[model samples]
Target: MEVVVGVDLGGTKISAALVDESGNIVADVRCHTQVEKGREFVIEQLTKTVGELFERAEGLGKRVLAIGIGSPGIIDPDSGVVVKAAVNLPQWEGISLKRIFEERFNVVAFADNDVNVMALGESLFGVAKGLKNVIFIAIGTGIGGGIVVDGKLYHGSTFTAGEIGHMTILPEGPKCACGNYGCLEALASGPSIARRAKEYIAKGVATSLSELVDDEITCEHVAKAASKGDALCRRLLEEAGRYIGVAVASLMNVLNPDCVVIGGGVAQAGEILLTPIRHEVALRAISPAPVLQSLLRENAGEIGAAALAFSKLAEKD
Candidate 1:
């Protein structure tokens, strides 16, 4: 059996998996990113994890072909270099991930933004399977997205095509981390949801959400509270959903994709969040596509990275 290694490197953790060509996860391993330990340290962890997957694949009589990485920030796919990353990655500027991994493992390597990889996974094997056009949105600490068109992942000329979160939504809305105002991320991301809750609590509005967490509240707390019918939390999440819906509707009109897939931790809010988004899209889009949750969930990135490796390997044939 032929297999490839896919590594999903995030701000907090690193997950590596051995995946077959058909998208089955043969074996997997994970470890802390320990970002404070610095870039080389994180690279070591990634290498060690891939080594473990390699051993496991060999034990199972699978031949390893290549390696692929799904990581944060803008990646130059041709160079396998991370041109820039968020603050969470801490000094991850201009790191040549592809060359390092290729030299370390003595195999061909491929890399792209993490969310783009997730879209690739979903398009090829998950909810968007057999579809030629798809959009994937990951709502977490921040919102990131990926676009797949004509059955292939679309990387714009600058390789920044899928930055759905940064789209200016309100024009005069809240300041975003990217120095933009009224970005979809600034209004609807996980941290944005928490911030909305905090703003409401500071206004002395009565709510059960404040009693749930001692420190700065999280989106999860708000989601749970909304699930229990906390009016304030419910309203906040619904408002966020509306903002997300507006953005998605714009995407639908522009791209006309087969579907939109929502994923990431914050998406766990499920129907409480999706219902409002659907309503807003219905109101806004000319002809809205179906908005679906990611079927692969957390494994999408790793699986997509493996798919990338497999695709590259096939090109050589």
Candidate 2:
């Protein structure tokens, strides 16, 4: 059997897996991304992990055909270089990931933004399968999106085309990590949701969330509280959903994809989060054209990354 290796480089961990053409995992491995140790260490970790995965695939009688990597930050897919990354990993900027990996592994290697890889994965195997045009939006510690057009992942000129997170919904609202004000991520991401909830609690809003967790209140906590009828938490989710809806609405007006898949940590909020998003999309989005809708939530990143590798292997044929 032929297999391809997929690596997902995140702020905290590096997960590499050998995936078959059918989107099945033949082998998998993981390692911590010690950010404080700097870029060399992270790259070394990725190298070693990929090598090990290759060996494991060999042991399983699967020939490694290619490799694909999904990483955070702005990537130039044509050049296989990372332009900028905010995950605080050392020396990640301007790294030629594809060249280095291909030379080291003696196989073709492709790299792109993690979210794009996820979207590709979904298009091939998951919820977005059979859809030619789709969007994959992940709401996590940060927000990111991927665009697939005509069955191909669309990496706009700079490979930064699908940065939906940076879309300014409120021009003068809260400060975002990109040094912008009122970007979608600042108002609707996991951290944003948690911060909003905490702000409400600080201002003496009565919420069961206050007593749920002692210290670091998270969006997960808020979702749980809302599930149990905590009015404040529900309201907070609704507010976040509204902001996200506005962003999605804008995307609908622009891309008009067949499906929008929502994933990542915060998506665990499930229907409580999606219901408001759908309602708000209907209300605020440009009318006449139906707004896009989410297909699947959760595991999108992993599955998408794996699918990307599998696709790369298939391309060789």
Candidate 3:
């Protein structure tokens, strides 16, 4: 069976896996990204991780055909270079990731944004399976999104098509890391949600979240508080959900996707967050798509990268 190496390069961690054509993970490994280190060191660590996966694949007698990487920032899929991504990792811009992997492994390599690859994985093998159109939104420290149309991942002219997080959801709300005011990420991301709860706690609103965390509250704390019927936490999450829903509603009207898949850490709030999203979409969108959760968690990027590698390999064949 043909196998490939899939790597998910995030700001915090680097996850690599050997996956078969059927999307089954044969071997997987992860380590801190050490993004504080220079680009050369991070790339070296990625190469070493891929080497380990290759060794494992060879031990299983599987022929490794290609390598695929899912990374953050504005990526040039054609060249497999990061055009610009100085937000999370310093000096990550203009990195020729494709050339590095191809020269080291002596195999075909492909790369794209992390969220885009996650959308590909879900559309092909996860919640949006067999669907030709999908919108994937990941809400964690920040929000990111990906779009798949007609069974292919859609990268806009500048390869920044799936920046759903940067969409201006509130014209005059909180400032986003992207230097935009009132972006969806600023209002509804995990940190944003936590900030809301923290603000409330500071105002002495009297909630269980303050008891859970000593210094600052997190989305997980808010989720747990909501689960325990904390009115403040529940309301905060619901408000965030409404903001997400409004953004998704706009996407639905324009893209007309069959499914919108939600994932990432904040989405663990589940029904508390999903219910409001569904409600707002139903109310605002002309024709709303089904909103679902991601099937794969940490493995989403790995599977999607493997699928991307398989796609690239097929194109060559």
Candidate 4:
């Protein structure tokens, strides 16, 4: 059974796993990103984590074939470099990630935007399996998307093709971190939902959410409140759903993918979120197409990174 190392690099932690061809995780390890220590420290930590995982798998009699890393930023797939990222780690810009891993492990190393890896995983072994031309959108603290065309991930000319979060939804709405106005992320992301709820609470609205937590409310709290029939929280989620639906409708008009799979933390809202999104999609979708729910949800990132490693190993054959 051939195995590969799959690494998911997030703002908070780095998760590495040995994955088999069947998408089974044989062993896994994790460590803090330690972003405050600078780029060199982060790289050293990643290298150590990969090395440890490789050694562990080898000790278990597993032959490691390749390594795949999913990073949160603009990644140049062909060059195996991270162009830019602003979330957790600093100074990751222009880092030759692939070369570092390949030189150290003496094996092929594949790296891509975190979301793209997630999409690849879904296409290969999860919900989008056996399907061509699919869209994977993850709505978490922020929003990100990946496009897979004809069973292959599409990296547009700069290898920054799928930036669904930056899509302008409201021409004159809130300002976004990317210096854009009214982006889908600005309106419907997890932070956006929490912000809206906070505003209502500040305005003296009587909501059950107020009694749940004292300071710094979160999307999870809002979802729980809404589930208990909190009108304000429910409204906030509906509003977010509507915004997400509008964005999906526009994307459908442009790409018309076979399916739009949504994942991430906020997706846990489940029917409360999906119902409104579906309603809006039906109302505004240009082609009146069907919207499919995500199969892998929160696990897409990890599994997708693993799939990418498997893909790289297969390519070498």
- Give per-model TM-scores: 0.96, 0.92, 0.97, 0.94
Which prediction has more favorable lDDT, 2 or 3? Answer: 3
- Could you tell me which 10 consecutive residues in candidate 4 have the lowest summed lDDT? 289-298
Candidate 3 has a TM-score of: 0.97
**Tens digits of per-residue lDDT for model 3, 84-119:** 884777687888788999999999899999999999
Error of 1 at 189 (Å): 0.7
Runs in model 3 lying further than 4 Å from the true structure: none
lDDT of 2 by residue, 50-113 (tens): 9999889878888887888888888887678999875655478888889889989999888888
Q: After superposition, how far is residue 285 of candidate 1 from its true place, in Å?
A: 1.5
Pairs of colliding residues, candidate 4: none
CA lDDT for candidate 4: 0.84
The lDDT for every candidate, in the order shown, is 0.89, 0.80, 0.90, 0.84
By summed lDDT, the worst window of 10 consecutive residues in model 2 runs over 288-297
lDDT of model 4 at residue 193?
91
- Model with the higher TM-score, candidate 1 or 2: 1
After superposition, candidate 4 runs with Cα above 4 Å error: 212-214, 288-293, 315-317
RMSD, every candidate, angstroms: 1.5, 2.3, 1.3, 1.7
Q: Which residue pairs clash within candidate 3?
A: none
Prediction-by-prediction clash tally: 0, 0, 0, 0
Model 2 residue 116 CA deviation in Å: 1.0
